[model samples]
Target: MAITSANQLELLQTAEAVAREKMIEPELVIEAMEDSLARAAKSRYGAEMDIRVAIDRKNGNATFTRVRTVVDEELLENYQAEFTADQAKPYFEPQKNAQNIWLRDGAPVEDFAAGPQIGDVFQEQVPPVELGRIAAQSAKQVILQRVREAERDRQYEEFKDRAGSIINGIVKREEYGNIIVDIGRGEAILRRNEKIGRESYRPNDRIRAYVKDVRRETRGPQIFLSRTDPQFMAELFKMEVPEIYDGVIEIKAVARDPGSRAKIGVISYDNSIDPVGACVGMRGSRVQAVVGELQGEKIDIIPWSEDQATFLVNALQPAEVSKVVVDEDAPRIEVVVPEEQLSLAIGRRGQNVRLASQLTGLDIDILTEEEESRRRQAEFNARTQLFMDSLDLDEFFAQLLVAEGFTNLEEVAYIEQDELLSIDGVDEATAEELQARARDVIEAANREALENARGLGAEDSLIEFEGLTPQMVEALAKDGVKTLEDFATCADWELAGGWTTVDGQRVKDEGLLEPHGISLEEAQDMVMTARVMLGWVDPDELAAAAAADAAEDGDAAADAAPAEDGARTEEAGA
Candidate 1:
């Protein structure tokens, strides 16, 4: 326990081992030891005394000395604030009333002797104070502290450049629900806000994150890592997809509903490569790895197209598409699909189309097959009438739509009253009238449908098909569909089949087309005229029927297509 000098060598070896482990030089430790001794000397000696300490670097040993100032004749006057020459007389009795008294050689030998007065001198013969065990222990602590400071500086230098760069880390601890990651050099703070919603980490778990920021605080530099930032996803792609990293493919835009689905728009500058395929990799292994990192979140990597309709179609994935009509000025798209596919195109809760619209930066409206068909028919009818009117009288009615680049009534229906007024020669009143006319057409169609439903439940007297009469036909001729071709083209019989009361009950066809509007005689004449014009009823039959019609003047042939016979074989043979 007390092997003295031999034990000191062992302690020196232990100190040297710690210094090497902490990357601190032994010379700094020795300097720290000397500094501690000087501080100790200052506390032991009075403030008027001077002290200094020096260490031998080779031996790890410390030495100290005490110093006194060599006083001159100037100290006799104003240096002492508390004790003036007169006031200090009791302390120095012989100089009671003498202001200019200089100490005579060997006048008095006392503790208050000033400097080397009366020929005093320093003796360089004094040996160094032998440091006791307690001073040695204090020196060890100071040395260790200096070593820690040096190591901290080294650590800071190593990691400073790594700031703002992603790194793999292990979960070291979780304090107050905040996870601390050990990223080799130092700990990084992963705040709750920086965490992805679908991910969770436990102690010792390995995770990757973006180094968002690094701050030099008092204790040390703080590394801030984020997993939720959109840049993190971009960076992840850059790391995983070789094409993007190589700059062959570029990511245009990224929109995400994080932890559920994300949409990324990408394009390739090179014609040989496909951007989407590159991101997806062979059999989707590339994106699958990324999705696994994001905890099974779905990623839709769509090809970025210059055409907005094409891009929007890709954005709304898994939806069967029929057609897309986009108006760039209005920034809207009308999506058309089969009637049964409407629900799919719109998606569950409309999320598919909604996200697509967001990704493509366009407003989308979905339409069913029937609605699209009606629209096409209305457009055709409008175009044909305009052409016929302009051709017959040189009124340029067709040019009205053509000049505006509109070929259809559907386009007119979409034009607002204000927009219509902006067109040349369209006054506000005229625009309003045109809008009213368009609306009336829609309303009349709806009312006809309603009246047809009503007649299905009640007697046909309240819901007569007035155009069945000759007088009514003349009136309806002004509304177009004047000829048999026009009437057949619109599938009038389909409308006839649905005629019913509003309550949806069937009504008796009691010659109702007559009393409520046109009479029976006129209805029969109109049917005969339609049959003759359509070439369905022969001229001889029409003549005979007219003779018979004049006697009885009742109903005529019902409108129906002939049954399909062996026409399929005949057409195939032809």
Candidate 2:
């Protein structure tokens, strides 16, 4: 009866209870409790003494002991457990030393048997005593701490692999505007910013969110949940749409204005399956389920395309696309739509186009047909006027040049005389006169440019520079880039050409160097040469000057012709 009363069944029951509550293994809890009791035992028996406690798994019985392992005296790595012959004489039976046998002391001994080889384990029983209240309380605290750490580690391991998965959780409580979620085994946090706009949660309400990330902290693993993330919608669709889960349909990209509207680009690997139709489900049931989960977020299941132009057309859904002008260099696309559909294409506050841009990964500039036409005409007029001013050509002749696909004076200055003669209402004599007049106009323009450049206070250093022409000097002076130092600070775009910002969109660039056909490399060389001239760079005058001389010769040739189209073409024909 006494043994039954002290069986400690309550301790075994408590370990089982805690294990169930903490969602951990019962054996782990029992081990933690045993280690805790051993630690508490050390406080009483002195820490230097080896003390251990083991709890019986079948019954509630407990055993206490001190463990010592016999190791070779020469092996100090386990010196605490190791013992020499004299130290362990009380434990080991000694035998007489054989002839030629030497003891560790290098002296003859009565017994020098090869005793206490490495790793000879030995245990001593210790009397079990009733622990005081203070000791019991300390043991309890150690057990709780160890169990709590083990629980945290278990939860981290469980959920860490499930990151990026859609998880269902219940609202536990709100802490500082963040919702604490009870996700079965562990807790998760849905931060305020990660919540969908205008969506609220009540205590004990079941909700679903994306497991955005999981981070192990000193306290526990922080499982971050999000309802507003773009992936959240994607995961919801993956849950409702079998095609996506089955790999028949692939979600290429997702963009969400969270709760307001969202778009998903879907493509099908299997030609037989319609990705958009599969995502929409029977009578839109699939997408509708996702929308409901998102608190009525409008969903647009766009068909994705491998071609960028086709994909962009699908991205801006519910609005018809008339034309798309893609600028590969600028990573931009201009969409021309019906005038009536502009507002819808752009959406309320530009939300539609903004989402489309995110989904397509391209800058979208939506314009009306009339706007594109007006822009084209404006460009034509600018070119026509430039020709009239620079080549002494009449409006009719300039318009004729522009009509023939001539954008700059260089095109006109270098074409074959026969190409000019081939034009309607133009004879060989007229062509010759036109070429001579064009040459004369450029030469006069050059002389006038020298006077204007000097009048505009161009630096004498720049004026005497071996490679700079009068026309280039005039351009530099006109643009407030006169001195070599001034030129060094300008970017390639500023020297060559770049777009102007309009309504946060880039418009056409009208830099002066564009008309002269200054290339990007040539602009860079110009800046480097200026740096050399100011002695800001190492003396590369020979190399820089040589490159600069080539640029100058190009400019000189450009100035000599100036719409004198037949100058170079005749040589090519010859």
Candidate 3:
């Protein structure tokens, strides 16, 4: 048999073993022992039989006891008193019921129930014994679970704020094709897709990424991260550009063809400060920082303009613009570049112009000098035909008859048949044939001329001159703006804003003329046509000679009217 103190020391050693093996606290062993002993005693004796058990955490010492009631004749009935009523005969009853004491039944039984039988056993001291391995293991598991629960709560508090923030981490280890990054406070998952193209990773390599998500999984906290998102660029720039952070400059939009190039639109509230310059920073330091973050991808910081043409021209930077022909109705623009600059303007694989078009919200039609010229020629030919068709004569026959000394079709058609016959080529048969042909041509020409004078519906007032290409004509038509007269009537600055095509193609701006196929001379010609059609000019004084011509016509009309009046008066007088 183990002595009390020796058994206590052995219990302490067992608790320490359990604590180390299960990684649980030693104090829990003493607590479990005390609880088990108290429960055992309660099962062996009724719950009403008072019992107690205690265990010392330091020594693992345990004690168990039973509390007994002291009773006499009066006390046996109450189970709490020590005196009998016979000791105070006058004060209480000491009859038959008194010797019978309280029994389980409410009525007194025949059997004697004095406070206690001399042979009744009241309490027993149960000693601690070795617990089964499974019981010890189960207790250890419960303690460890509690410890882990506390540890998880601590970790969650540490990492939740870091979600969605950009972080730099060292590659810790990789598992199941996913890489784990040590983000100081916790581990973050670097998904395979988030790895930059052509970028390799190894243990201990430093990497930068945006925290995409943080979630609590069964094992622990999980953090998801990414590197390729465009917002990553925006966030980096905001860190670099003070104006953006201060809200003085706004980044309106960002677009990227990642790993290659990116375009950002910016606007500033203050007109004095350029938004592009502010974003670019001093000597390009601010933008360069963002570029470094992106691994050398080109960044174009374009100043956002209300005019689509101007915006596009800016978006296609490094390539000079000769002109911007805007078509507002169709949201398109044609960018004209000189023949030599065409390749530069279009860029490799046409990516430059294509991205520019997308960035500026315009359908860009890039035109070369030859294409522009052909386009202009076609437009001129159409207008010339329309103009000629409106004249009251068969255009070919009118020229022919005019060469033959008949100035107008009316004069040719009105000639006498005999007079026509008198001419060298005019036999009676030829004369009749020529005269008949003249009348038919005249009627057809007249009808066409009338139709030409009237135009096609409400878009009529805008007379697009024959000389301008469809690009130019379409641009002017969209402004509710008409001919050069209408265009020039407004100040040059007014037309400087953008315009679009009916089908949404952008007309190239005039500034692009040299770079496009048009020379300075052609630009001037188009500008002149634009100016003349719009009727813009410095105010010139009306000539004093205008009064003399009016006076002369007035006198001639007066003299003619009086002569007719005098003839009528003479007839009345007669």
The model with the greatest lDDT is: 2
Give the per-residue lDDT digits (tens) of candidate 1, residues 222-278: 778887665666778889998898988877777665566677778777777767777
| Best-performing candidate as measured by TM-score | 2
Mark the 10 consecutive residues where model 3 has the least summed lDDT.
564-573
Count of clashing pairs, candidate 1? 15
Could you give candidate 3's per-residue lDDT for residues 319-356 as a string of tens digits?
A: 77788777443324788888888887887787778767
Quick one: ranking by TM-score, best first? 2, 1, 3
C-alpha local distance difference test of each model: 0.59, 0.77, 0.59
Off by over 4 Å in 3: 1-164, 174-179, 213-222, 325-334, 361-365, 372-574
Sequence-dependent TM-score of model 1: 0.43
* Tens-place lDDT digits, model 2, residues 321-362: 899997654435899999998998999999999999999878
Compared with the true structure, model 2 gives a TM-score of 0.62
The per-prediction CA RMSD against the true structure, in angstroms, equals 29.3, 14.5, 29.2
